[model samples]
Target: MSLVIDIHTHPAFFEAINADEERLHLRQTCLGLYKTGAAPLAHIFNQMKYAGIDRLGLLPLDLTTTHGVELVSNAEIHHLVSLAPEKFIGFASVDPRRKDAVEVLEYAFGELKLSGLKLHPAKQKFYPMDEGLDAVYACCLRHNKPILFHAGISLQPDAPSQYARPEHFEAVALRYPRLRMCLGHFGWPWVVETAALLLKYPNVYADTGLLYFDSAREFYQHVFTRTLGQHWVDRSLRHQVLFGSNNPRFEQIRMVEALHTLGWRASTLELVLGGNALEFLG
Candidate 1:
């Protein structure tokens, strides 16, 4: 049997909320592209079916303070998982700057039984290696839960691009050598830093989420084939790459097909498609 795990997704019940100019622009851009408002749970399941995905990972964003946009809370994610335990695995979020942040994460893991944690440094207005975040990393390390960090540019107007750079995450990876971490979006426009981390640290990995988007395909094609050279793809990649569809932005099945265009070996294909994520989630 084949198993495909889409490890990065922002499945949400989106609603109009207050936002800065940048946030408003992003909202309009998405609305123009996807031509929809909210991606309710039922619609998400139908997309999963179309993609032939066996399990879906749902990530919640916690940018209440920085973006002033109300987001799907960890509690809501837990409830969604409960609604369809067999189909969904929820990844919780906690803004490290929040008071009692570690405590909130403890409750999320202990009470909610969330499968993983998602961090967006840019939106949260902290560098990934910020000393203040040590406590949260300690929580994840102790709980043996993987963290999916947003490791690229964010559309939020106030977001600092530097905070999301993949290299900063190298410091955290070094500090907690055993903690599993994934840099989502292949750290686009910084693929070199993202690839270097993947090769240097056994615990660090990346996902092909929005890389398959129409605008990003050319960039990824160059990275996989030309920019980094073939060895990067044929050897350095191996099982460190994972399949992820940032659903609603890109269709999952189409993302799978986009990856197939690379013409990787059968074993590499299997690992990238699902095997790697299963091992990471374990």
Candidate 2:
């Protein structure tokens, strides 16, 4: 199927080299496009092509100050989006802990006109229901933008991720009924919970971005079919589940095989391929 949109990705911004070579410099400046062969893995265009993904949902991680140090900034994300307007969709990341969290959202959406937001509760050191972020949600709601939340239980240990649970988002969903919310990685361990949210809420959606092979695939299949129901596949093929290649993580073909094995209809497969993103992004 022909693909025109991809709902998730992180295209590295061109980083500036510094003499320090310390953590600060390495984390902040050692990025952007590399002069390696054709397109650099961090480059949006190249990453898109390498994964057979076209347009992308660009997520810049800026929260989790300590943990999300390598997280990209809204400024860099906006620049990349502007560089190739036809190939990318921008989503801003704001540290909900910052007093200027709402202001950050303003700059990204109100000023840059970005279409979405990436909220990482772990990196931000807050819960999805953190009162500090009420205004941030309000700002996105006021602007009518969607939010791609890095949700579900944490897979890593000693990781400072507090808002990985899918249930944490229920209040946000109930509060902002019109705000389009997508669970990155389909809420993983909480697929059943995430599936329930999708069933209960109109504004909720999921993406097939980073799920890998073997056991992970089987677990996802079981939940998608067992919990979401056999008919769930038919229902979500078009717009509910989106396709994403979490770069530097999983290959495109690997995700493709898993999605195809579900035996989805041609239209639904086409939607998961890219149609869903186009509808949401375009």
- Cα lDDT for residue 58, candidate 2: 76
lDDT (tens digit, per residue) of candidate 1 on 1-282: 368788887665333222244554455453233343554567667777777787888888776666554355798788778878998889989988887789989999999999889998877889988899899999998898999988887654566778899989999999999889999888876888899999899999998875533444564566677656656755777778888877656666767766766757777878887888887887
TM-score of each: 0.87, 0.81
TM-score for candidate 2, residues paired by index: 0.81
| Error in Å for residue 179 of model 1 | 0.8
At residue 1, candidate 1 shows an lDDT of 33
TM-score of decoy 1: 0.87
- The true-versus-predicted C-alpha distance at residue 234 of model 1, in Å, is 3.7
lDDT of 1 at 213: 36
- State the C-alpha lDDT per candidate: 0.77, 0.67
Each prediction's RMSD over C-alphas, in Å, is: 3.9, 4.4
lDDT of 2 at 8: 69
Overall local distance difference test of candidate 1: 0.77
